[model samples]
Target: MIRGEWQNPALTRCDSKLAFRSLNQAAIQAERASSRTGELIIAYTCFDCGAFHIGHADLSQQLAHTVSVEPGCRECNLPIPEAKKRRARACSAKAIYCSDRCQKVAERKRRAQRQMASVTPQ
Candidate 1:
């Protein structure tokens, strides 16, 4: 890409990895614009505008202000591993268990408990 190519406003340019100076500048700009105190973790350099854009590292696609959960496996009550946790968060439908074995065990327990209750007088 030539130097003049960078000048085009409508160019579909790729994101350039921001340098420390660029990130610092973006941080300062963000801080000045907002009264809230927060550090910028993600930075991207715009090739067309030659400007640095600052943002948070929320690759999970969750809402900006929402609290992210480190959810436990429902069936075993064990903490979900990092990769699985991310997958659960990313999934459109909620995840119920860490594995099929735990899910089957829980289902069997529920069925047995229901049978026992039904067999009793009360």
Candidate 2:
């Protein structure tokens, strides 16, 4: 989740959404985690206004947490194709994604029935 969007766990993780430095940090972290294969970092950018939001998610299982990540695109806070990852990179400075597929597919489901999507800060 982006800054101010997180409330649970005291929201220890929150960073800028459109900072270049942030994007680089995310790329490096993802590169190391995925063995250089590259991880998904979804970035939210507005089409009409070009405004964006950075989403935070962990692809590596090593960094496991008790928190539950509901299925959906981390950026834009909307449900999209699994192949369409968020534009945001993941890093202390900013955010990024492993692949376009992983980023986009987030929160996306193939099931006929769908569950309501919400980003509740518990």
The backbone clash count of each candidate, in order, is: 0, 33
Note each model's CA RMSD in angstroms. 11.1, 23.5
- Candidate 2 lDDT, 57-87, residue by residue in tens: 4565335524676555444554554433333
C-alpha-based local distance difference test score of model 2: 0.43
lDDT of 1 by residue, 4-25 (tens): 4345533434244333357678
TM-scores of the models, in the order given: 0.36, 0.18
Q: Which ten residues in a row have the lowest lDDT in candidate 1?
A: 10-19
The TM-score of predicted model 1 comes to 0.36
Least lDDT summed over 10 consecutive residues: which range in candidate 2?
Answer: 87-96
- Candidate 1: C-alpha lDDT: 0.63
Q: Which runs of model 2 end up more than 4 angstroms from their true locations? A: 1-20, 36-122
